[model samples]
Target: MTVTHALEGDVLRRQDPELADLLLGERERQASTLQLIAAENFTSPAVLAALGSPLANKYAEGYPGARHHGGCEIADVAERLAVERAKALFGAEHANVQAHSGSSAVLAAYAALLRPGDTVLALGLPYGGHLTHGSPANFSGRWFDFVGYGVDAESGLIDHDQVRTLARTRRPKAIVCGSIAYPRHIDYAFFREVADEVGAYLIADAAHPIGLVAGGAAPSPVPYADVVCATTHKVLRGPRGGMILCGAELAERVDRAVFPFTQGGAQMHTIAAKAVAFGEAATEAFAVYTHQVVANARALAAALAAEGLVVTTGGTDTHLITADPAPLGVDGRTARGRLAAAGLVMDCCALPHADLRGLRLGTAAVTTQGMREAEMIRIAAFIGQALRDEASAPRVREQVRDLAGAFPP
Candidate 1:
């Protein structure tokens, strides 16, 4: 059976009906709605099986064949496969597949390259960047002095010249490039050039778009950046985990930072699932999926525009589209709520340089379900219709259910 087909089988219904009810309800929700959250995706049954395996019961605290504990032979095998697969999939000289989550991986990368109070240049959180980039609440911001640069006013894209100026003046120890809500292609090469001039390490956080990079559908930072961090899930459609890829020259420091500095004990089951995801991503089928993801996003952005919504950057170059309906005078939160009621799931994102909010929609999950341009247009109509009349949400929800049913995950 296909990996996805196996996930449809039964699990834990008899032992704990309450938990099973919650689990199954989520399955129903996923199968019934248009999931557009940018950083989410549906994992295959093989990944699910790995997550539920006995490998989770062990404690493997070090690298393969050199763990601090006993009975780690199988753990070593799983981790080795994950590590090798990540390296092969991304064309990196070294890979660390044991970070518990993407945020932890970011922290580890920082620890690997910088000491406390070291200065860094990164994109701002209020803009299209991550909290770990330089949010005052996050550890990276607390421990490091991070100068944040944002998108240009009219273009709604990163200002390379501004970044270059900051790198020259700040003289940061490291520079971070990547985002959580950006809707355009990142200029990683330019970031690298700035870093080189400043004698700084360049780190690219490709957590949201790594799948596209892995499938060769997006430009990769592997050859340009000093270190790269990514999540195994999201567009990659693996288990929820984190990974680090870097050159062999930086591998030893990266690995040591991940193990003894940032985290301890590998999640081997999740790593096994990551191995499956990497294998799947390296195939032709996965390449086709990422291509569809980008196409569908562009299509959806155009459709949303057709309905009078303002698409940021005039559209998207990746799988995500950020649209603001505030011009229609509707509160962004209320519009998002209406969309949710209409069986469309997405998040209200912060619009840079404005007091307004916007919706950050993605096509990764829908593309995974074999959706294309036509489906994107229909979904956009549902969004516009729902925003116009909340009373029409119930009817639109049924239409959403019908469309969702036609394409099972």
Candidate 2:
């Protein structure tokens, strides 16, 4: 049998029957639901298999050729492949494939560049910035003094003028530009200019848009920022892991920070999976996939808005959209729960300086499962029905199952 068949057969015969049942059930649920979680995606079988490989048993406690542990030949190969693929995909001078998650990657970047108590500037959390950017509860905020920039009230979008003004006034060591809820394209070039004028480093958290960048569907921070951190799982469709990419100047510090300062040992299985994911991303089909993700998001946004919901910034330019359900007399939590009951998965998000008027939905997961504009329309209709009358959830749920059946996982 082929490796794929052998793996499948082994999973069926050797895995615990109960756990296997649960896995299959979850797969079915994903395949059937209108998945709209902004931070989730489906990995290819090759990438999935790589993540489950025996490489997971290895312990390579350092960078290639400088490991504290012995017998690292295979681990070295996996790490090297992951690094090379990342550099090729993002056109970076250096890439570190060892961060276990995006948060770790962010931590390593901060650890490498800033001393404790250094001033840092990032978008406010309520405005869609991530916790690692500067939430006081997170290391970035706790260790470094953090100032924030926010979206414009009139446009519901980032105000570059305000960013530059804040950068000049605060003179932070690092200025981060990216968000989880903002549904518009980032102006990386503008950010680069702002950072230069203020003599601050520009760090981009492309955790959500990395797939779009890889597919050439969105602008890349690789060419503009001093450091870029991203997760492999989101739109990149890899294992649950993270990577750090930087220019040649900061290469050594980045590697050391990822090793002794942040992580102990690299996860070889995840590295191998990242390599597979990067390879897949270089293909034309992946570009088409990224385009489809954005298209589906727009279609879904339009449908939701038609149902009297409010879409943040009017619409989306990426695979996710944040909507306001106040017109429907529902809070984000209520809309989320009602939609979940109707078999549509999404998350409730709080927007900055606004009453709890937003629900975040993404198309990456369903798009991965071959969902297109038609499916998004149907899903949006179901969400509308659920919000219109939570009592009609069962009927809408059946429709979701039928739609899911049309595209089995």
Candidate 3:
């Protein structure tokens, strides 16, 4: 969550000129280039204000009115508003906006549901899953025995039958779904049914598609998942924070886990921004943004495939598309570097059961800049040109600047 602070002029200059200059430089960088990072977005100005608000000074060490420390009257109000907005936005019985990040929210969910030795099933990180979903280095994997399910070798989509077979065999205490690089709509109901059959808790990590779910562009996991973990940023277009949504039955445990178990005092300022973002997500305007985001992603996937790039899963139903650049005669890592130098910003993910890596491109930021399918097609051409030869980058870079200027991020 690198914030290029567009602070209103001289206040920052008077305090720290160096930092203010750097912020402007970062803003210029974003303005001149394209952002294709799947798990990133440019939050609204209101969210930036909230992030830098005086609430950052608060030390309210507990939830709302139940704080261990005093002087929390406004903190309680702000948190309560965030909770209400989150629950209303997602149609959940309870919402906890206090987990410091997406990883912390996932940690809180695990703390609420599983003991140290409990078994959990999640998508493997190398194949587009998150680290918190049970990478060997993450706490979720170290503390608990974690088995993973992955997308099919040939088709780049999760196989539910494989998931069910693995669940039955492992008999995990929890079955986690939702992915960072996966480009299709998730079947939360199917995951729920499998969890029920295996008597496992279902934690849907909606970090990537929370906004889509809010706008009805994707299925909501709240109705089927026992717990939902998401970041307020990314496609949600909010602050750099995390939240958890669950039923009333698990509210207390989730809250306690987020508080003393996983993290200490809540970040009141970020929570306020989360509330603002949630309110925005509930609006018709944001719904349109989500729709455009999906449409642009699909268009980008098609355009890339048309250029002979191997777009994983054929195309996307959401804001992200994972493609292998091999057909362009470049490895994923080399392609990413060349594209960035050419003024397009994206990262690579490993392909399941393949030696080559997949590069994930997202449309959230560009959609925010008001670009649509036509722009996606153009950007894909730039990508194709750059990947064909680094010598083509100077021309592509100029094209990207003109395009980005037209949108003005």
Collision pairs in model 1: none
Residue 233's lDDT within candidate 1 is 90
Candidate 1 regions exceeding 4 Å error are 1-11
Mind sharing the TM-score for model 2?
Answer: 0.96
Q: Each candidate's lDDT (Cα)?
A: 0.90, 0.88, 0.91
Residues 1-409 of candidate 3 have per-residue lDDT tens digits of 2344345467788899898888777888998999999888888888888888989999888888789888899989999999999999999999999988999999999999999989899888877889887787888778999888888888878988889999999999999998888999899989999999999999999999998998889989999999999999988999988999999999999998988987988889999999999999999999999999999999999999999899888999999999999988898999999999999999998887788787988999999999999999999999999999899889999999999999986
Report the lDDT of model 2 for residue 133: 77
Cα lDDT for residue 106, candidate 1: 94
Off by over 4 Å in 2: 1-15
> What lDDT is reached at residue 329 by model 3?
89
| Prediction 1 global C-alpha lDDT | 0.90
Best by lDDT, which number? Answer: 3
Per-candidate TM-scores read 0.97, 0.96, 0.97
Candidate 1 global Cα RMSD: 1.7
lDDT of 2 by residue, 1-409 (tens): 1133543456664867676666666766776786789999878889878977999899889988889999998789888988999999999999998999999989999988889998888888989989987887888888998888899887788977889888989999998988888889999999999999988998998999999999988899999999999999988898899999999999999989999988898889889999999999999999999999999999999998998998888999999899988898889988889889999888999876876847998999888878899888888788888998989999999998898878765
Error of 2 at 291 (Å): 1.0
Q: Tell me which of candidates 2 and 3 scores higher on lDDT.
A: 3
**Superposition-based RMSD of candidate 2 using all C-alpha atoms, in angstroms:** 2.1
lDDT for 209 (candidate 2): 96
